[model samples]
Target: MENLKYMQAIVVDKPIGPSGLRLVNDYPVPEIGANDILVQVKAVGLNRADLIQSYSKYNPPPGSICPDIIGLEYAGIVVRVGSRVVNFKIGDRVFGLVASAAMGQYLCTHSQTAILIPQDLDFEVAASLPEAFITAYDALVLQAGVKLNQSVLISAIGSSVGLAALQIAKLYNCIVVGSSRTPDKLKLAQNIGLNFGFTVESGSFVQSVLEYTRQIGVDNVLELVGGNYLKQDIECCSYRACIVIIGLLAGIKTEVNLALILAKRIRIYGTTLRSRDLSEKIELANVFASEILPLVKSGKLKPFITKVYSLKDLHLAFNDLESNKYAGKLILNWS
Candidate 1:
């Protein structure tokens, strides 16, 4: 570490929930390894994982800079580059995901983990893109093999990841059907190229999805809500369809009909971006940089940041995130 001594960071003083977050001004700036770069954080994106980590319901994988800090993705200017790091130098704008401890004035991560931000992209919007966009892309495009003109159903369509899935699926000329408990959010999703939107009530939207696809069912389903929704997800999928389970917001345990899964040849994949190893993360970052970054730079893809708040008001931001009132991401302005 150079002469830079201290930085501000949010420490989980209580570690209970949103209200447990606290800010500290004199936290030591982390030392970077030879392959790492120190980022001067401009903004940080809030995710459901952040809340889970805050409450001790989740713990970051080993090697995280600070396990108690509750953040996953960040965007900022590169302030210091380690001796062997040549991919980025001082003053480069970059954005990427971290296992933990990104909600601070300075963060050190592997240089390969950071992608140079598009010149036209705002830091706040860039902050909102990494976790949601990367997860959506990996699950839908890479794992599910979603292709052009195929049809997809997204549960919890109002979420940040859901929105990112909607846009990416559309870019492939795929038809999108989305579901949300809130009617207004469904309507909003429809306005943004969603082929159809279902207001999920008592699990009735399964029939709506089937109807929308003319009883044939969708080609893929991004199953964000697990539990009871899994059975319905099975019902809504067509023969040979894939279901990527990215979230379990509804609950874990669920009853499934083995015959239906066997008969339809449905494939299910459960994925979590943060739990992966460093090498895997770097590989994913490379894919994102090559495939998605150009789209982002061309304005064909973008982050939907619904709200922005300062680090001091993080609890309020988390409250907003938990309320599910926003259509996309909630961001913290760290700059």
Candidate 2:
């Protein structure tokens, strides 16, 4: 440990520009606080949040490592633990979310938020789990009160978080309808037990959804495409249905029918993991550790990693993600 001094981290040179991400050597290793643990990062998950931050649309929360490093999730080996930390020790494999600065060779996070990596999970796969899965779980299960035999409609079904929502809803025996602009992604979503997978070329997906539910409308909607889908989502919801807005891959501004919301008594929630307080994040972590980790260990829940890139090739990885050609999470490996 004494021999390790400098670290390598991905830093955004131009946050407000279209693209300016690079790996920086000779970065200072972060110091661990009494409740924190230092991890030697093995892999980092690529997320749309990362891109949004790179473009200066989003900023890191207070207490993040630095302003330039934009990653939100990572998995690695625990190299050292703080004196007050009791749940983890040196050599434990762990994965978790961070507010920022995680796409580095080393990272530091509070011990309470980092979960022990299951024995059966690989480093790359583990790295992909936290951000997408937690967003899905928190939005659908915790906030929206999804129940067994209910119906859910997910837009952008090819996204990592959308797939996670589909699987978790299915785990509770919920009927799921997924829509994607890409026909191939719709087919893949169908193979993963989607009750209805349709291409969202236009408003036709709403008709397909109405036909599938016999015109009753869905009980829940995981709305990832934020623009026109917002209005369509309102049209397709059942009475008192919950709609959780987890992404804005489409444009953020959209007009919704206020009368429909009032008539249907719809509950709309917009959430992002990066801006939550420390206590809230810790609570989320505990819930994931107790409720979701076992499912992952048993193979009932899994991370969908469609592509892998070395840390040096991060620019190409970002390009690939922006192309919207991939169906699942993209991972960047440090080793």
Candidate 3:
């Protein structure tokens, strides 16, 4: 990267449709801060948020240099470390998250936010871990404080975060039940240790969860599909159950029963990894490094990639994410 003038990247050149994305060879290579590290990105992971940002629906968080470049997580080698950075050096394998600008050949991120990628994981799987696994761990363990043997319900069980949550929840020995519109996805979740999997074909899964839990209701819910899913989550929640809202994929407007919420004394929490302060991101990264890294290194916790696409096939990657047929992450291989 020494004296390099520009780098290749996929940019949202036209923020109108799914095919609005295009590959450019001359996107300016990013610069590192005093505490940052310069990375040669090897693989990147796609999120629904990326497609939404390209369409001008959800803007990347503040301090983004290339809001037009859409990506949330990447895995690569550290080519340079900032002046104040001491933990990492050139050639260190790492993976981390960003508000935006991660789909490029090179990216700069704070050193504290980057997790060392172990030898057991390759760039494609490493790229897939940060956004999905970190988000699931942060929301379930750090934020929701889920405990062993607790009954948990995760909406959209086939989603990237949903699959990550299934594996993480089982690590705590939680009795996990998940809902998905796709039966195949539910089956996928079951194969990953989800205790019970149900389909919300009619937009409801309260009865299924209740019956599985013997009418006791779930103690925690990882709500990723919002909309009426929140209403069903509330109905299936046990007394004082904790429900953490992470995504609003299923429309934002939903008429939830405030009366039931009050009666059950349920606790509701909404979370997003983006738009967070730098300090908060560093804290979450540290938590992942200490608690989640060992499991990942041991192959007990792994990323479930739906498909791997080459950088030249950026359009197809976008279309696949938009189709939402996939249960796990879609990876863009740069190498």
Candidate 4:
């Protein structure tokens, strides 16, 4: 590896809207600390969090560095390793979550937060996996405790996280039902292995859930849209079911019937990929490497990258993601 002190990075100077691609270069290459590894970034996967960060609406923890680089997960080859780092060496292909600045051409990540990229996975696919798959794995498998043979409900199935959850749930042998607002999108999801899916605008959405679950309701619900649908989701949840809220695409404010929630003994948890402590992020990365990375390598857990953009096309990439014009993951390749 070269002893490069500076590298190109997409640095946002202001909180302009999605159309602004005014990222300047010449940002100093990040330095690795003990127990950290520096990666020469190959590609970055865009997430809703990136959009939020770019707009300055997502606040970073106090005294954090480079809050405006605006990406959360990336894949690359390790260019340097701190003296204390033992798990990886220079030239190892790796992918993982970062505190921030994943959109840049290089990043320094804690050793525990990074995992070796599977030999069979391409850089674009590797970049697209971590955030969505980890979030979905945490919500569906860990938080929700979705069991084999249980019925699960997922909203916004067209989103990358939702799609990843669907795949993971199916891998666990759970029965999965998905919902989306676009009929065509719902069809695409169904074709991709969702057991059942429908547009939310369909008047019989609740009835469809009941029919799919044989009137017993779903054992788990992954709620991405959180508006009037909260009531509908509550009605479709089985006794003692868990509902994990990962996004508020529809809106935040919603009325819940406490009596109904109590009667069903329902559990609701709101979660995000960002805002988690470093230890937790490292733990999740370990879990993924042990339990999920094998599947990814085997092609059982394939990442769905709907589009790829050059780093110079950051604005176009972000705009497509913000417009919700594509399904699955959108990747930004540094090459």
Candidate 5:
């Protein structure tokens, strides 16, 4: 490590949402472990978790560095690498998801999970990627084992992760069913390879999805909006279908039918990258780096970024995210 120590950070000062954040100029820089790398962060991707975490609704894994800093995704250049790190070196451009402490100029995370930023992509775009794409890829491909010609339903299709899942499903020539409250957002999903999309008013899309699938029901679901949406997910799934719950935008607790789940033999999974094991994170990073990221470089996949805000405008970005109207991600540029 260099003599440089303190770094600017956005600290969640209290359980009071974004208004409680404090932009501190002298937060102590985090130290790296033997298998870690220190990054000079350039930009951050604001996740919904950051909002909830601000109000103490979400918590990072025990012992995560700088837990009060509100961020999960970042892109930057590696400023230093630990003794046990081999894949990355100083000054290599990289981006990845960490548990916390990303809304700052400096971040330290396990090197195995850090992905090299493609030569053609900038920090802001790279920042827009890790959280959304990683979560979608893990849920749809790795956990669910989505196959070609499968029918997949992705809720909240306008959200960043939902769009990422939509694009991945399209890669397999799968028929995608998306539900969003806003018609314009559904149109955006349709443009980005959504096959059957309609407005969801009361968190019910079972009729539309089953009708489109010829009553056979969808084979897989990326259940981004939980609460009432999950019950509908079970109702619309084909026999033995997999439902990966990636978010709880609708709410947490819900009234789900055990009989429906049992009768359909539905397999439901809940996942989050924030507190996953290191081996799992490393595996996902490798698969994403090799299989998914190349498409972005070839111009086949576009990372959705609604806007980039200066670090000074983070407060505004928080409110924008809370509005739930943006089609994609809101980035905070630390540079």
Candidate 6:
């Protein structure tokens, strides 16, 4: 362990609506356990999960120590190591997803879940990679079993997770189709190597997708919007298609055609990052290190960070994320 006594962080006494920022100050620094390493946080990534948690909708597991600090992933330098820790030491750079309490100055993480940051990567970009990239990898490779030459469609393509899915699909040589509600975002996605982009507001999303695939529907659909678009997603999916639901930005309730699902043999599954156990998170970290991290180090995979805010300005950061004016990731910097 290095010379460290206390650290600064953001805290929320009580979460109200998204109207005002609720971050507080001078929260105590965490201590390292036998298998944990204390990290001096440099940058933290913000996700929709933070927004949901702050709205009093998503709660952490029972017996959680800190319930008000709402952050999932971060990147930083290790400042102290526990007795049983082996993979990391003080001064090493690392990044990973945490259960909670990451929107602060220092965080203690299990050694197994923390991946060493690549030498070529910046802290801000590394912070943006973990949550969204891991979720995309899990959905496309682990759950969907997407292979080479398959057709994959991703909705809400302007989001960080959506962009990560598009990049991962392209890496596996799959044909990628991206959708957004705005023409500028669609054009931006196309410019960034997405093969096909469609505007959902114009109401020809299914037609554009069919034309792109020559009437053969996409083999896999990563559905981020879950309300009225559920039926549309089912309609555009191919026979025996795998549709993984990862978000409900549009709304939750939807009336779908069950007959179409049965007739086409479509499979639908819903998943989230915050609800997984420690073992599952360790496995995800290992898979990402072996199969995904190298791509980022090689410059094949890149994260686009559109905005960054200091830890004290968390409310402004959340406001920007909720406003949907940005196209990439919004991050919180401790420095």
Give the alpha carbon lDDT tens digit for every residue of 150-210 in model 1: 9999999989999899999999899999989898788778877888987877845777888
- How high a TM-score does candidate 4 get? 0.95
Show model 2 residue runs off by greater than 4 Å.
16-19
Query: In model 1, where do residues sit more than 4 Å from their true spots?
Result: none
Write candidate 2's Cα lDDT for 5-76 as tens digits.
Answer: 798988877775325887789888888899999999999999887888778878787667765777888999
On a 0 to 100 scale, what is the lDDT of residue 299 in model 3? 83
Residue by residue across 181-262, what tens digits does model 3's lDDT show? Answer: 8999988899889899888878568888888999999999999999889999999999999999999998998999999999
Stretches of model 3 off by over 4 angstroms after superposition: none
List, residue by residue over 1-335, the lDDT tens digit for candidate 5: 57988989998887898888889999999988999999999999999999999898897889888998889999999999999999999999999888899987799999998999988899999999988988988999999999999989999999999899999899999999999999999999999899989898874678888899999999999988888899889999999999999999889999999998999999999998988888988888888899889988887778999999997787898988988879999999998
lDDT by residue (1-335, candidate 6, tens digit) is 34555556555445664553355555767777899988888999998877877776776666443556667899999988989999998999999998787776788888999999988887898899998899999999999999998989999999999888888998889888988887777777887778888888745477788888898899999998778777778888999999999889989998999999999999998888776887898999999899889898887887879888886677788888888878879999878
Supply the global lDDT for candidate 1: 0.89
| lDDT order of candidates, top first | 5, 3, 1, 2, 4, 6
Tens-digit lDDT string for candidate 4 (1-335): 56676767765567775754356667778767898888889999988877776677775666444666667899999988999999998999999998688877788888889999978788999999998889899999899988888888999998999899999998888888999877777877887789988787745478999988889999999998777778888999999999999888778888888898999999999998677888898899999999888888887887888999987678899898888878899999987
Q: How many clashing pairs in candidate 3?
A: 0
Best-fitting candidate, scored by lDDT: 5
Ten-residue stretch with the least lDDT total in model 4? 59-68
Pairs of colliding residues, candidate 4: none
Off by over 4 Å in 4: 1-3, 202-204
Give me the displacement of residue 281 in model 3, in angstroms. Answer: 0.7
Q: Provide the global lDDT of candidate 3 against the true structure.
A: 0.89
User: Model 6: which residue pairs collide?
Assistant: none
Per-candidate local distance difference test:
0.89, 0.88, 0.89, 0.85, 0.91, 0.84
Cα RMSD for predicted model 2:
1.3
